[model samples]
Target chain A: MKIAVDAMGGDFAPLEIVLGSIEAIRENPHMEVVLVGDEQQIFTILKENNEQKNPRITVHHASEVIGMDEHPAQALRKKKDASVVVATALVKDKQCDAVIAPGSTGAAVAAALFGLGRIKGIDRPTIATPIPTVNGVTVMLDSGANANSKPKHLVQGALMGSEYAKLLLGKANPTVGLLSIGEEASKGNEVVLATYPFLKKLKTISFYGNVEGRDIPKGTVDVVVCDGFVGNVVLKFAEGLVTAVTQLVKDGIMAGGIFAKLGALLVKPAIKKIGKRLDHTENGGAPLLGVNGVFIICHGSSKAKEIKTAINIAGDLVDRKIIEHIQKTIEVEGAFKYEYDE
Target chain B: MKIAVDAMGGDFAPLEIVLGSIEAIRENPHMEVVLVGDEQQIFTILKENNEQKNPRITVHHASEVIGMDEHPAQALRKKKDASVVVATALVKDKQCDAVIAPGSTGAAVAAALFGLGRIKGIDRPTIATPIPTVNGVTVMLDSGANANSKPKHLVQGALMGSEYAKLLLGKANPTVGLLSIGEEASKGNEVVLATYPFLKKLKTISFYGNVEGRDIPKGTVDVVVCDGFVGNVVLKFAEGLVTAVTQLVKDGIMAGGIFAKLGALLVKPAIKKIGKRLDHTENGGAPLLGVNGVFIICHGSSKAKEIKTAINIAGDLVDRKIIEHIQKTIEVEGAFKYEYDE
Candidate 1:
């Protein structure tokens, strides 16, 4: 099996990306990786790190890099050889089983949707990320794929999210919860309220009723589904909050003088572990679900470890035939009713 | 000024309610309190605590109690003399300057909307709460008043929230930010997209365009305005997360052996201060903005101190004429354009 890695994306680009690909292929001896970026940059990193001798890694040269703030569609259209676009194109051309990029999420989504195309009967693809919880992690879908979603899109997201959970989290029957303002079915905006009845009628996924935002960290449901707007806001907020809280604690300890400093030193290791637990980097990458092929989008500041995990996840998804399972779920459950929108 | 207190509401009930009222009136000798609940229960708590002799405190008989889970409109209708409803009635009838309740938020909103009614020319009333940040607090509103809102409603929320920040956080000119998916004005769903232009046009408040969810804790804006659905979800999520993170840290510290244990003891005071800083009780109560009368809603699990703070907040609102200010802002800006929806 082979994977395409975007070697010129994220804050720490070619160096981190190239190192991660080397590490991933070294661990998985059966897998080969095509590093999609500038051939010179990739080769330089490999040589400098004494990893150029690795047989499992090859370079697929791409000239341009997309800015993190670049408009998705415009970036892809203009930079035909962008690392992310080229990486996704490898999967689209059937040269690679999966694509991994630590680039602009919008760019990744745009590239995936346009390059690999959507699966049969899927209206809008979703970006699903697992939020760390006390018990385990909850799969939050449409973490930022479509800003405006129809009811059917959310139902599709639930089914897709459920399958993602089953394969990734190893949950046989993942419970799906609609993200809403209140726990009651009647409580939410028009889209959620309209989607509520449809979700109840779907027999494919185990549908739990509406779950509030508090339910995310509580791990009340295995899969929590919503439109991209709400899901994105919640995801970003959680990420920022974990960092802010950790900083606040450190500042508080620092301001408390010598006794507090001594105590902080004692509990430093425990606090480090706690911080690791709260970090999203521990979860590797978020999957762009509902697309035809495997595309895992990592954080823009992703380091080598996170990229390696993303590669491993991509391999697992391909081996487990997650796309086939999702395709079958949507078909069997008859979730794609185009007439419903009309 | 006289404030009506809902004694039978909240998890702690009449005990905390009575004690808080006593503490409130004792501190503010110029203020009077009406304890609205079953007279026997109120007397039992007051006399048991030997506070029945105070001339500033009086009991108003309320025959019924509304359960926390009871339907809002249904509870107000069925339990006509419910303590929350009666307390609100005191304000509606001009017998009390303000009302404070650590009860079901929905019930309080319903009573205020029905009893006190919307202030003249205000299209919808909003529930505004102060979320603690590293730099003071950011006032967020329509925290959970109307689940569905028109574009004009959000504009009103911003104006009211700005006034709220001024009165509560003491920001003379609060910069209002529309909570959305991105910093760009073009980002967000249909509601926010439509409301953005209105907020930009409104000269009454200093508009800061759009703010993402992370900005809530970052304190990027003085006031963050959104529809009730999003606002309520964010508020609850923040509350739940603070608890979960603190618990995770404590559990981690405990599992780290004797060194960590000793450290925990030493930094315990500093940690306690951080906890208090994050505590919503420190902010006192969330105001039901846009209503004709002042109504401060405390947390359902509020203790004596929290209730006391709510009472104090109510006094401040009444004394500062917050309602009059809100009414003046709305009227001057001409935000109540009922025909605009058409």
Candidate 2:
């Protein structure tokens, strides 16, 4: 399988991106990576890593780079040869099976939306992020992919999320839930309230009723759905909460006396184990589901290992035919459009 | 000051509620309690606690009780003598300074809205929940009070939240932030984006730009403003995340050998200290702001200590004249309405 990588997208840029591509290729012999960025920069990093001679990796020069802060839709339209745009074009042109970028989420989303476009029956592409639960991971969708979403869009997200849980996480008949403030059917915002009845009527999914925010960690449902606004807040709040707890514990341990210091020494291994589970690098990137092609958006601060894991994820999605499954889910639901004034 | 207690509200109602009211009255000589619920049940619990003759504590007969799952507004309208409604009515009738209820948030909000009504110039009442940050509490408003809110309502929420931080939390000039996915002005859902310009021009508030979900725990802003849907999700997600992290740590330590168990003993005190800092009960209840009278809502599963803290909070809000500040905020802002099709 071939994948396109936007090498000039993240904070670490070309160096980490180059190293990660080489590692991904080495780990999977059948996998090939096309690095999209400035030719000189890519070649320099590749030469330094002694990966210039690797047959599994190749460079595809792009003339421009989209700034992380630029307006995504406008940037995509203006910078036609920008690295991410070029990489997405490769996916459009069938040169690569998927596109992966560790850039601004908006830019990646814009590229996928404009370049690869939405699937035939899909209303909006969703950012399906894997939230680490006590048991495993729960697939939460529309994680800030679209700022405004209709009830139909959320229903589409639920379906896409269910497919993702099944194909990616290997959960059989993943239970889907609408993320709301309460467990009752009467609870939640207008969008959530409207979507509940639709979700309950769906024949394809194992529809659980509304799940509260606390249920995310409890793994109350394998697939959680909400608008991008709420989903993004939930995702980021979890990230921030984890960081806060870790810091507080560390401060607590340090503030304690000599006994605390000795205790820390003894519990170092256990702490490391928990840390590994909490680390963002251990999990791969979030998939931009419901798009026509496979696209993964990684954290901007992701290192080489995260990129490697992301590539592995991209390959796995292709191997499992996730996009096809998503298409099928939408088709089976009859692709019924429930339009709202955008 | 007289405060009405909803004796039939919470999961441990009548028992824990009666005990807490007695504790509150004993703690504050100037404060008086009017228990609203079944007179027989209240007396039974009061007798069991040996507080039947407390001069500061009085009982009011309210025969009906609103179930936890009952429709909030409909319940309030139908169950006129329900404990929560009766308690709110005491405040409405000027017989009490505040109302404290450990019940359904929706029921409490509905009761306050129907009983006391919105303060002048406020479109909808809001729930201002205090999130415990590393520095202190961040007063977040519209924490699921209204599912649908106009942009103007959010601006009013920010102003009210700012005043809440000033009087309640003792922040001199609490910086207000519009909770969004990014700090950029262009970021967030349409409501948030529209609310941005209005917030920036509000002279009554120290309006900072957009803040993300991560900023809440970081205490990046003293007042975090968002629509009810997002705010509720953020609040619950944070609660869930804290629980998840705590459980993970406990499991990790228990899985370790004897040395790890000894380490846990050494860190127990320090952990307790930090846990107290993160504890919701220590922070008190969330005040249903923008209402004509003071109404504080506690979690349904609240214990006696939480109820005690909530009563203390109610007394503090009444003492601080939070309702007057909310009125002043709206009056100063010119009571402008940004109309949406509701």
> Chain A TM-score for each candidate, in the given order?
0.98, 0.97
TM-score of each: 0.97, 0.97
Residue range B1-342, candidate 1, lDDT tens digits = 999999988899988888988888889989899999999989988898787888889999999988788888988889998999999999898999999978798888898899899888787888898887877788888888887878888988998898888888787889999988878776788888988988888878999999998898888999999888778878878777877777788899889999999999999888888788888888878999888899998888888888888888888988899988988888888887633553
TM-score, predicted candidate 1 vs. hidden true structure: 0.97
Taking the tens digit of each residue's C-alpha lDDT, what string does model 1 give over A272-318?
88778777777889999999999999999999988998999999999
The CAPRI quality class of candidate 1 comes to medium
Q: Per-residue lDDT of B104-210 in model 2, one digit per residue for the tens?
A: 88888888888899887788888898888777778888888988887878888988889889987787899999999999998988888888888888888999999
DockQ of each: 0.73, 0.72
Q: Which ranges in model 2 have alpha carbons more than 4 Å from their true place?
A: A337-342, B337-342
What residue runs in model 1 are displaced by over 4 Å at the alpha carbon?
A: A338-342, B338-342
Question: Cα lDDT for residue A2, model 1?
Answer: 94
Clashing pairs counted in every model = 0, 0
Q: Give the TM-score between model 2's chain B and the true chain B.
A: 0.97
